[model samples]
Target chain A: MDTFVQQLINGLTIGSIYALIALGYTMVYGILRLINFAHGDIYMVGAYAGLFLATSLGFAANPSAFGFVVTLVGSMAIAAAMGMAIERFAYRPVRKFSKMTTLITAIGMSLLIEYLFVFFFEGKPRSFPQLLPNDNITLFGNATISTSQILIFVVSMVLMVILQYIIYKTKIGKAMRAVSFNLNSAKLMGINTDFVIAFTFALGSALAAAGGVLTAQYNPKIDPLMGIITGLKAFVAAVLGGIGNIPGAVLGGLLIGAAETMVVGYGSYIGIPSTYRDAVAFAILILVLLLRPAGLLGSNVQEKV
Target chain B: MNWVKSIIVGIIAIAILYVLNAAMSATGFFGIGIDDYQSRLLVFIAINVILATSLNLINGFTGQFSIGHAGFMAVGAYASAYFTVTHGKAIETSLSGLGETVASSIVLLLAIGIGALVAAIAGLIVGIPSLRLKGDYLAIVTLGFAEIIRIVILNIDAVGGATGYQVPGYANFLWIGIFAIITVVVIHNIVKSDAGRALISIREDELAAEAMGVNVTRYKVTSFVIGSAFAGVSGVLFAHYNKFLSTNDFQFIKSFEIIIMIVIGGMGSMTGAILGAIIVTLLPEILRLLPAIQIGETTFQFADLRLVIFALILILTMILRPQGILGTTEFTDFFKRFRRADKPTGGLE
Candidate 1:
C-alpha cells in the first residue's frame, strides 16, 4: 500500500510536468492546427536558460526561494520570447501553405534547435544546479516525498491556476479563444489573429519552460535531446485528452503519467520488465486511439461535405 | 508483340544489371574500377529510392499520413536477418551443387520473401486499426506504433536486442537495384491504374470518394500494406547488404528522412521520389566536404554542422516551394511541357 502511494505520488509529480507541457501543445494546436514540434525544444531551452541565469547570477551559489523564483521567471521570459520569434519567422512564412508544409517546417525547426544546441553545448548531459535545499518528508506507512517533487507539484499547480485565470478572466485570453474558434472570423471581428497566435505560442512556451525547469529540479540531468521523448509523450497526452481541449490535456497527462509509473512499479508481476517503460506510453496511446478516436474528452464533430 | 517487347526489355535490363554488378566488383570490368565508396553510395540511393517511393504511395497518393515507415522497415530487416543467420548456411549448403552464386542468390531470395511477408502482416495489423483515424491523429498513432515496435525489438534478446544484430551479407548492388526498380514500376503502375485514381480521390476528398462508392477503408489499408511491404523489402536489402542490423538505424529520424525525400522531390511524383532519394542520400556526403572555418581560438567544422544546414534547407524548401520542386509532375512531363509550350497541370487539385 505504501509503495502504491509512493508510486502514485511520483507519477502525479511527473504528470503535472507533462500537463504543463501538454498545455502548450494543446494551445498551439488549437489555433494553428500545427503540431509545433519545436515546442519540446523550447522546453529544453527553458531549462538551459534557467541554468545559465542561476549560474551567472550567483543564484546557484546560495539557493533560496527568491533565487528559484527569479530563475523560473527569467527562463520563462526567455523561452516566451523565443516562442514568439519562432512563430514570426519559421512558422509565419509557411503558415499559408499546405498542412504538410507547416508540419515539415515545424519538424525542421525542431531539428535545427536540437542540433544547434548540440553543436554549441555538446551532446553530453549536464547536471542542473540544485536551486532548493533537498529533504524528504515521510507521509505515512513508510511513504515519503522529496522537496523537489513537492516543488514540481506546487509550482505546476500554481502556474496552471494562473493559466486558467488568464484564459477565463483576461481580454487576451478571450482573443485567444476567439482566434482558435475561427482565425478568419476573429480577424474580421478586429482581433489581431497574428498577435493572438504569437501570444498563444508565448504562453505555451512559457508553460513548457516551467515544466522543463521543474523537471530539472526533480531530476537534475539536462541534455539537448531530453525534450524529444518527454515532448512526444506530452503530445500524446494532449491527444489522449483531445488535442485542442485544455482541461483534457491535463487529465490525459495525469493518466499517462500514473499509467507509466504503475507499469514500472507493478509491471514485473505481469511479465513486463521496467525496460518497457518508454513503450508503455505509446501502448496506452494506441489503445486509447483505437477505443476513443476523438479522445476521452474530445467531441466528435461530424464531417462536413 | 507487346509480350515480346517486354521480354526483350527484361533481358536487356538483366544484362545491364549483370554488367553493372561486374563493374562494381573488386576486379573491375575492362580494368576500369568503381571505388567502394561510390558503389556504396549508389547502393544506398537505390535502397532509399525504394523507401521514399513506397512511403509516397501511402502519404502522397493515398493522402494518409503515416510516419511509422521505419517500423515496418525494422520488422523486415530483423526478420530476414534472423532467418539468414539461423537457416541460411543450411540452405546455401543444400543448393551448393548449383554453384556458390546460385546458392547464395537462392538464400537471399528466401530472406527477401520472408521479410516482405512478415512486414506485410505487420502492416495489415497496424493499418486495419489505425486507418480509421484521420490526419494528425493518424500521424501520432503511426508514430506511437513505430516507437512501440522499436521498444519491443529492443527487448527481444534473440535478435541481439540492444546489442545490435549481425547477419550474413547475401545482398549486393545488383539485387538492391533490381528491387528498387521493381518497387518503382509496381507503385507507378498502381498510381496510373483505376485503383490509383481511387487512392488519389481519397487523398483529395475522403467524403466525396466515399459518396462515390469507393471502398475507402479497403484502398487505404491496401496502399498502406503495399507501402509497408516495399519498406520491408528495402529493409531486407539493407540488412543483407550492410551485414549489420541496429534498431537505432530505424528510428523516427530515418522515417523523417524518407518523408523529407518525398517532400523535397515532390510528393506523388515518382521521379520526384527518386530524385529526392538521391539528393538526401548524397547531401550529407556533400556537406562533409565543406571547408572548416577558423575563428579566433575556435575552429568551426562545417561537417559537424551538416545536420543544421540540412534543417535550414528543409525549412527554406518548405517556405520557398511548399508544393515541392516537381509538384506532382513527372520528370518526363517537364520535357513534354518544353516541347509543347503548354501550361503544366495535375497536382493536389
Candidate 2:
C-alpha cells in the first residue's frame, strides 16, 4: 500500500511536468492547428537559460527562495521571447502554405534547435546546479517525499492557476479563444489573429520552461537531447486528453505519468522489464488513438461537405 | 509486339547492369576504377531511392502521411537477417552444385522474398487499424507504432537484442540497383493506372474521392502495404550488404530523413524522389570534405554542423518552394515541355 502511494506521488510529480509541457503543445495546436514540434526544444532552451542565469548570477552559489524565483521567471521570459521569434520567422512565412509545409517547417525548426544546441554546448549531459536545499519528509510508514518533488507540485500548481486566470480573465485570452474558434471570423470581428497566436506561443513557451526548470530541480541531469522523448510523451498526453482542450491536456498528462510509474513499479510481475518504460507512453498513445480518436475531452465535430 | 518489346528492354537492362557490376568490381571496367567510397555511395543512393519512392507512394500520391517507414524497414531487415543466419548456410550448401555465385544468388532471392512478405504483413497489421485516422492523427499513430516496433525489437534476444545482429552479406550493388529500378518502375506504372488516378483524387479530396465510388480505405491500405513491402526490400538489401544490423539505424530520425528526401525532391514526382535520394545520400559526404575553420584557439568543423545545415535547408525549402523542387511534375514532363517549346509552330498537333 505504501509502495503504491509512493508510486502515485512519483507519477503525479512527473505528470505535472508533462501537463506543463502539454499545455504548450495544446495551445499552439489550438490556434495554429500545427503540432509546434519545436515546442519541446523550447523547453530545453528554458532549462539552459535557467542554468545560465543561475550560474552567471551567483544564484547557484547562494541558493535561496528569492534566487530560484528570479531564475525561473527570467528563464520563462527568455523562452517566451524565443518562442515568439520562432513563430514570427519560421512559422509565419509558411503559414499560408499547405499544412504539410508548416509541419515540415516545424520539424525543421525542431532539428535546427536541437543540433544548434548540440553544436554550441556539445552532446554530453550537464548536471544542473541544485537551487533548493534537499530534504525528505516521511509522509507515512516507509513512504517519503522530497523537497524538490513538493516544489514541483507547488510551482506547477501555482503556474497552472496563473495560466487559468490568464486564459479566463484576460482580454488577450479572450482573443486567443476567439481566434482558435475560427481564424477568419475572428479576423472579421477585428481581433488581431497574428498577435493572439504569438501570445499563445509565448504563454505556452513560458509554461514549458517552468516545467523544464522544475524537472531539472527534481532530476538535476540536463542534456541537449533530453527534450525529444519527454516532449513526444507530453504530445501523446495532449492527444490522449483530446488535443486543443486545455483541461484535457492536464488530465492526459497525469494519466500517462501515473501509468508509466505503475508500469515501472510493478511491471516485472507482468513480464515487462523496466527498460521498456520508454515504450509505455507510445503504447498508451496507440490504444487511446485507436479507442478514442476525439480524445477523452475533445468533442467530435462532423465533417463539413 | 508489346511482350517482345518488354522482353528486349528487360534483357538490355540486365546486360547493362551486368557490365556495370563488373566494372564496379575490384578489377575495373577498362582501367578507370570506381573507388569503394564512390561505390558505397552509389549503393546507398539506390537503397534510399527505393525507400523515398516507396514512401512517396503513400505520403505524396495517396496523401496519407506515414512517418513510421523505418519501422517497416527494420522489420524486414531483422526478419530476413534471422532467416539467413539460421538457414542460409544450409541452403547455400544444398545449391552448391549450381556454382558459388548461383547458390548465393538463390539464397539472397529467398531472403528478399521473406523480408518483403514479413514487412508487408506488418504493414497490413499497422495500416488497417490506423488508416481510419486522418492527417496529423495518422502521422502520430504511425510514429507511435514505429516506436513500439523498435522497442519490441530491442527486447527480443533472438536478433541480438541491443548488441546488434550479424548476418551473411548476400547483397551486392547489382541486386540493389536492379531492385531500385524495379521499385521505381512498378510504382510509376501504378501511379499511371486507374488506381493511380484514384489515389491522386484521394490526395486532392478524400470525401470527393469516396463520393466518386473509390474505396478510400482499401486503396490507402494497399498503397501503404506496397510501400512497406518495398521498404522491407530496401531493408533486406541494407542488412545483407552492410553485414550488420542495429535498431539505432531504424530510429525516428531515419524516417525523417526519408521524408526529407521526398519533400526535397518533390513529393508526388517519381524522378524527384530519385533525385532527392541521391542528394540526401551525397550531402553528408560532401559536407565531410569541407575544411575546418580555425578561430582563436578553437577549430570549428563544418562536418559537425552538417545536420544543422540540413535542417536549415529543409526550413528554407518549405518557405521558398513548399511543393518541393519538382512540385508533382516528373523530370520527363520537363523534357516534353522543352520539346514542345522547341517546335512552337504546332508541328505535330
Candidate 2: residue B304 lDDT (0-100): 91
Judging by lDDT against the true structure, name the best candidate: 2
Deviation (Å) of B16 in candidate 2: 3.3
lDDT of 1 at B203: 94
lDDT of each: 0.91, 0.92
Model 1, residue A299: C-alpha shift (Å): 1.9
lDDT of 1 by residue, A1-305 (tens): 99999999999988998899999999999999999889889999999999999999999999999999999999999999999999999999989987878888988899899999999899999999899999999999989999999999889989999999999899999999999889999999999899999999999999999998999999999999999889989998998999899999999999889999999999999999988998888887888888886789998778667
Candidate 2, A176-240: lDDT as tens digits: 99998999999999998989999999999999999999999999988988888899999999999
lDDT tens digits by residue: candidate 2, B1-349: 3335545664677678778788886677886767888889989999999999999999999999998999999999999999999999999999999999999999999999999999999999999999998888788888888888899999999999999999899999999988887787788778877889899999999999999999999999999999999999999999999999999999988998998999999989998899999999999898889888998988998889877987898999999999899989987666675565556543322
Best by DockQ: 2
**Model 2 misses residue A62 by how many Å?**
2.5
Kindly give the stretch of ten consecutive residues in candidate 2 chain B with the minimal lDDT sum: B340-349
